[model samples]
Target: MDSIQQFLPIIAMFAVVYLFMIAPQMKKAKNEKKFAAELKRGDKVILKSGLHGKVAELYDKDNSCIIETMSGKLKYDRSAISMELSKSLNKPEAKS
Candidate 1:
C-alpha cells in the first residue's frame, strides 16, 4: 500500500502529460496524414513555408507533389503542406 501511494503522483503526472501533450500531437498527426492522403490535383494549398499554390500532380510512389504557383511549378514533399493554413484558405467567405 505504501509503495503504491508513493508511485501514485508519478503515474498521475504521466497521465496528465500524455493527455495534454502526447494525445493532441498524435491526433494532429493523424489528421495531417488524412489531409495529405486526400489531396488531389487542382486543390489549392499552402506550404509550411507560407507559399500558396495549387496541387499540380501527386507522386504516390515518392510521397511528393508538384505545386503550381504564380512563378512556376515546383516539386515538394507532401509533408511540406500546412493543413491549418490551407484549410482556412479554402474555407468559404461569409457575408454579413
Candidate 2:
C-alpha cells in the first residue's frame, strides 16, 4: 500500500547504487585476488605499502613473498601485494 510505495523509491536507489558502484568495485577486487594468487618469483609487483619490487621468492603454502628491495630482500604477505608491475623492478632501479 502507501508504505510500500514510499519505500520503493529508496530501495530502487540502493539497487542502482550497488549496480553502478559497489558491484564493479567488488568485481575488480575479485579479479585482483585472482591475480595475486597467481604471483610467482621474478614477477615485479607493487605492494599495498607502496613497495615496488620483484618477487624473489614465493612460499605458496605460507602465503608470503620475498621482495628484492634496494636495501635487501624483504618479506611480505601475499595479500599485501597490490598488483603486478609491467617491467622489471631492477631496470628502473639502476636508472635513478
Candidate 3:
C-alpha cells in the first residue's frame, strides 16, 4: 500500500501531462498530416521558413512538392509546410 501511494502522484502527473500536452500535440500532427496529404495544385501554402507559394506539383512517391513562387519554382518536403500558417494565409477574409 505504501509503495502504491508513492507512485500515485507520479502516475497522476503523467496523466495530466498526456492529457494537456501529448494529446494536443498528437492531434495537431494528425491534422498537419491530413493537410499535407490533401494538398492539390494551385493551393497557396507557406513554408516553415516563411516563404509563401502555390502548389505547382506533387510527388507522392517522394513525399515532396514543387512550389511556385514569384521568383521561381522550388521543391520541398511535404513536412516542410506550415499547416497553421498556411490555413491562416488561405483563410477567406470576413467582410465586416
Candidate 4:
C-alpha cells in the first residue's frame, strides 16, 4: 500500500505528460503524413519560409516538390512545405 502511494504520483505524472504532450504530437505527425501523401500537382501550399505557391511538380522522393512562387519554379524538399493552401484555387496567381 505504501509503495503504491509512492509510485502512483510518478505513474500519474507520466500518464498526464503523455496525454497532454506526446499524444497530440503523435496525432499531428500522423495527420501531416496523411496530408503530405495526399498532395498532388497543382496543389497550392505554403512553405516553412512563408512563401506560398502551387506544386509545379512532385518528385519521387518524399516531400520533394517543385514550387512556383514569385521567384519562379523552385525545387523545394517536401518537408519545406509547411501546410497546404485550402482556398484561392483558380488560375495560378504566380507563374513558374
Please estimate how well model 4 matches the true structure, expressed as its whole-model Cα lDDT.
0.79
Q: Global lDDT of each model?
A: 0.98, 0.80, 0.97, 0.79
Winner of 1 and 4 under TM-score:
1
The C-alpha TM-scores of every prediction are 0.96, 0.73, 0.92, 0.81
CA shift at 29, candidate 1, in angstroms? 0.4
Q: Pick the candidate with the highest lDDT.
A: 1
lDDT of 3 by residue, 24-90 (tens): 9999999999999999999999999999999999999999999999999999999999999999999
- Candidate 3: minimum summed lDDT over ten consecutive residues — where? 81-90
lDDT of 4 by residue, 16-39 (tens): 999999999999888777767777
Considering only N, C-alpha and C atoms within 3 Å, which residue pairs clash in candidate 2? Answer: none
Where model 1 places Cα greater than 4 Å from the true spot, the runs are none
The C-alpha RMSD of each candidate to the native structure, in angstroms, is 0.7, 4.8, 1.1, 5.8
lDDT of 2: 0.80
| Lowest lDDT 10-residue stretch of candidate 1 | 84-93
Candidate 2 on 29-90: residue-level lDDT in tens? 89877877788778877887787778899888888889998789998888887654433443
After the best TM-score superposition of candidate 4, give how far the Cα of residue 51 lies from its true spot, in angstroms.
0.4
Residue by residue across 1-96, what tens digits does model 1's lDDT show?
A: 999999999999999999999999999999999999999999999999999999999999999999999999999999999999999988999999
- In candidate 3, how many Å is residue 66 off? 0.5
